[model samples]
Target: MIAIQDVKKLSSEEYLSQEKTNLIKHEYINGEVYEMPGASSAHVTIAGNMFFLLKSHLKGSNCRVYNADMKVRIDRLNVFYYPDVIVTCSEEDKGLNYYKKYPQIIIEVLSDSTESFDRGDKFADYRKIESLREYVLISQSKKRVDSFTKQDNNLWILESFSEEENLVIKSVNFNCAVSSLYEDLD
Candidate 1:
């Protein structure tokens, strides 16, 4: 994500208003908006696969799976991020038209450009959402996934999965082969 230089910071309302009509997507953080770059084919495929699998699994349940277009709002941090995939079962979130405040699971397809941010500051911000149970990072370059599950004490535990393992998302009670996420990419 790159900040639009020389542009003054915007209020949350102002950012949302512009985001709706803007052709490109921007992630809002601490009153500043950063331009989100286009995803690679692999990134798109992995996110699509995860969304499809989760959506299918949660069809009859109250949970809803959203792709990258949906935004997850961290009100406490005054930030909004477009996660690669999000699973929300909160009734309150269902009524909101623009963003979800209570996502149980958040998935981000990692790229060289955004990996560090996703792993560091972004993860820290996401952890502030009380309803978030798991934060997942999937590598588009390899069949690997890293999951950070929030413990009862509010601590996060990391579990890494390789190509041979099934990536288990306990928060959503869903699991899938790691290879399934990288369906059609070189």
Candidate 2:
């Protein structure tokens, strides 16, 4: 999806109102809104698998897992994103029903069109969230997972997982097999 940077900048109120009435979802960053594209089957399956694994692992815990429909707000960066998978254990986030401001983990399933955005600008924006401990990227075409864990306010360390290995997610306290994420896909 193309970022509508040419369009007039919208205020948070205007974007929120328009987003509620519009059928297509849009992400807001620094006053610009970008219309989001629909996810492919592989993207959906991988995201679903991660959500299931995280949810199952966090059962009886205070953490809650949300799918792509839920919005995440990076207050410091003034950005909003519909991450493929969002896990928040913060009690501050639980009080809100519409959008979460304190997400512990955010996962994005990469596609050909969005891989760069997810890895570059989007990751930069997500890093502004103080509660974000881990940001994960999953490849749709390969059994690979990349995780960036925050070492400090300004330091983030990258860790990668290959096909045969399981991604040990410390933020959410779980391990998910990379192969299981692409089970039905070639």
lDDT of 1 by residue, 1-186 (tens): 657734688889998999999999999987888899989888898899999999998999999999999999988989999999999999999899888999999999999999999999999999999999999999987789999999999999999999999999997789899988888777
lDDT of 2 by residue, 53-122 (tens): 8989999999999999999987777788899999999999888877899999999999999999999989
RMSD of 2: 1.6
Q: lDDT of each structure?
A: 0.92, 0.89
Best by TM-score: 1
Residue 179 alpha-carbon offset, candidate 1, angstroms: 0.9
Score candidate 1 by lDDT: 0.92
Prediction 2 global C-alpha lDDT: 0.89
Show model 2 residue runs off by greater than 4 Å.
1-7
Model 1 misplaced regions, further than 4 Å: 5-7
Q: Candidate 1: which pairs clash?
A: none
Report lDDT (Cα) of residue 69, candidate 1: 96
